[model samples]
Target: MLAIVLSAPVVLSDLYARRVPNAWLAATLLTAVAATLLQRLLGATPVVWPSLPGLVTGLVTMLPFYAIRWMGAGDVKFLATLGFLLGVRALLPIWIIGCLMTGVHAVCMLLFRLPRIAYAPGVSTVRQHLHASPLWQRSLHARQGRVGLPHAAYLGIAAIVTVLTPDLMHWEGA
Candidate 1:
């Protein structure tokens, strides 16, 4: 889907630096907007649609986490922007799926005692480099504990899976 294609970088950035760059989000917004307009011009439902209620829903759903300082502002904004693009129908399922995945990740961390790579105590995120990241991902890093989960990564994964498999939350009918 177009949303998946556009959201990839934001997800990678979140995984890399525990951050979602505004540039990438802005790019996504612009692209979606352009695509929506074009789709309308063609007299069809926009594939890259936007939803005001979804935008609000995303912010409302995630704001509590941000207020607790458990989630970064980037994560919240990323979700909100994605909500705007993917619409309300998809956002809730994405959120539920992301939370479940994060729970699994936490359990794995506890079970395996995942090692955390330490860094200088006062290193800035802007100056940090992804030295340990793979050759293809020599692009991002930050001070992160192994126990902490980057919600954006999980949410991005959820969004992709939800879009690809829309019946994920409709199993009740089965």
Candidate 2:
């Protein structure tokens, strides 16, 4: 619940700017820590400080994807922050859900633009078709491929949803 509520702004920001501001992330972290301290002082169950393994897990998991340019640096940092706030166990499930969501979005976009799809079973046939198209059409095709994925928005949403789902991954608490 805390994770979900706190990350709401992040989701909105990512959706808007395709970027996660460092200041907001840091402030959220600080606020979470302060809230946990207050909870402890009140003799409530203290929010578990996310473990070292969780932090490392987040970094190790996203680093390769970032290296390949599949996702931006903001997404990597967002995942790492999520790991710190949630736990190591939540990272992969959230990531998987986010990826599946992105895949679904891509499929829907493709379906919506069905006319743009050109199916070719063979590589030679693909080249032949490409060459057959006018230069203007080819340029138009290239430009259409530049849609931004805005992975951080997807990922932040996934993380929030994952936390909201009851007993997801059998988590006792974060």
Candidate 3:
């Protein structure tokens, strides 16, 4: 519930602004630590260690993709934050399911846009296909084109769903 609540703004920001606010990410990290300590103090049953290793693993897992421009740095940081909150066991499943969801989201986007894009001329390459069409140009002042998946939003959704669904990812309180 905490993870989901924290991620809502992230998902909204990514959807509208194409960027996740750093403040939100920082808040998430602090909240994860504070939540863990509070849960412990409250004697929450089935408490799991907030795994720093899991956070590192999550960052490392996404670094190459960020380096290759397949994923954003913000998305990587977001996943690491989620890993810290979720612990290693839940983080693994969340990452896997998020990846799958991102793929599905990409395919659906492509399929939905295919008809609108098919008639555009000189769009022969993969890069051109992924970018804005000559037929429908954006203003110069508009933000730069987006490539690949908005994986942060997808990951946020995945994390929320994983945390909410029984037998998906085990939450400490669950």
Candidate 4:
């Protein structure tokens, strides 16, 4: 359930923001539920497919990030679903990689003149600016800039590592 917990924020953010594709979330959730039930009925060693609910949840959660221009909708769903399928144990590395990717993207945004605010230490000034600006105005003023790498690609790599090295989650004895 680690994956589910970790991915919850991303999926919920997406869903709250309405940035995710409904069909995709629905399909993933359905698949996961079915797979989990099957695994229990058949007495499988581990059930992986039911983890898709986490993925769906992640996708839905990512809508906020997407709306805020923090991440793409696809990235949110992909990582969340990946976490669910892999489980909490498999999510450690994925989170590490995702964080790294997010950092890199942030740095690139800073370098590339994306719609970001200049750093100001004064809380009063920041508050004043926020109050003066319209809700969507801030997003509008922020330029649509490019972050070289796609987050999904990084997530894919993380998923591969987690799947191949399941021991990372320390489930060896369990």
Candidate 5:
């Protein structure tokens, strides 16, 4: 519930503006930390504490991508927030799945643009009629080959996937 509340606005921002808002990230981080502390105060064994190491690992792991200009600062921060939400134990798997999903998304974007690349660069195709409107339609149509994934959006999807397929990610205790 908290995850949905915190992430929805960030997702919307990423989809619409190609950016994540700092305010959203800060709120999410604070909420996560507060939740961890509150759980500890209630003697709930502090599941969030064990996950704390994920914050470091997640940030460190993603730093290279951001350094290379493959990812934005906001995206990196968003991923670290996900690390905190998922915890240390679930961090690696979640990150891996996110990466996989990103790859799939990239491939899809490429595939989507292939027809445009091959034939009418400026013309829309009958295929567009067959396919439902995709999330990145505005950016993809406007920019052509220069299109890039609003990668932060994929992280949100990865988080949802983690929740849905917890068994696959070995999220038993986490």
Candidate 6:
């Protein structure tokens, strides 16, 4: 359930502007709340609430890119939501995997010279430029032509890794 919510934004964003839709975010948040409640009803012990930390970490890490116009607001929001849904224990591995996936995607894009597209700094900036720009614009104004790997895909991959290796987050100090 969490995985589904987390992955939806990535998939949707990839098809569009690598931006997570508001509907998706709303749905994910609702689902996460319900799931958490359900888990509690089922007698699952809560370790630590991870969503807040995950959101903070994601925002901090992605801020630079957002500032430089490298990523969209939706992407940042999606990552933070993913962190909240996954919680701290599971989120670490997911973050690791997501980063790895992003790196791989970046390398591939660089090699392929794929055009990258992103929203300019302000809403007004984007609005001002939209009329004058091509339908598909790169997010960054780089010499190699804008091309970037969809982070959502990597985020999904990371979620899968964490789900499969749930024990990885458990620490038993010997």
- Better-scoring candidate (lDDT), 4 or 6: 6
- Please write out the lDDT profile of model 6 over residues 70-154, one tens digit for every residue: 7766667766777777665666677677788788777754654433323325644665677467654543332134235667667
lDDT by residue for model 4 over 8-27, one digit each (tens)? 54344333332335455456
Q: What lDDT does the true structure give each of the candidates?
A: 0.74, 0.74, 0.74, 0.57, 0.69, 0.65
TM-score per candidate, chains pooled: 0.72, 0.69, 0.71, 0.47, 0.71, 0.61
Model 2 regions lying over 4 Å from their true place: 37-45, 110-147, 171-174
lDDT of 6 at 154: 70
Residue pairs with backbone atoms closer than 3 Å in model 2 (clashes):
none
lDDT string for model 3 (1-174, tens) is 667876788776666556767888788778777877888799886345467987898899889998998888889998888877777677766777778988898887776568556445643455465456652344222325655566788788888887878587554543
Candidate 1 TM-score, true structure as reference: 0.72
Candidate whose TM-score is highest: 1
lDDT for position 97 in model 3: 79
| Model 6 CA RMSD to the hidden true structure, in angstroms | 9.7
What range of 10 consecutive residues in model 5 has the weakest lDDT sum? 139-148
TM-score computed on alpha carbons, candidate 2: 0.69
**Residue pairs in candidate 6 whose N, alpha carbon or C atoms collide under 3 angstroms:** 50-88, 51-84, 115-146, 116-138, 116-139, 116-146, 116-147, 117-138, 117-139, 118-139
Task: Let me know the TM-score candidate 3 reaches against the reference structure.
Answer: 0.71
Error of 4 at 63 (Å): 5.7
For residue 52, model 1's alpha carbon misses the true position, in angstroms, by: 1.4
TM match of model 6 to true structure? 0.61
Instruction: Name the better of 5 and 6 by lDDT.
Output: 5
Question: What's every prediction's RMSD, in angstroms?
Answer: 7.1, 8.4, 6.4, 11.4, 5.1, 9.7
| lDDT value, residue 166 of candidate 1 | 74
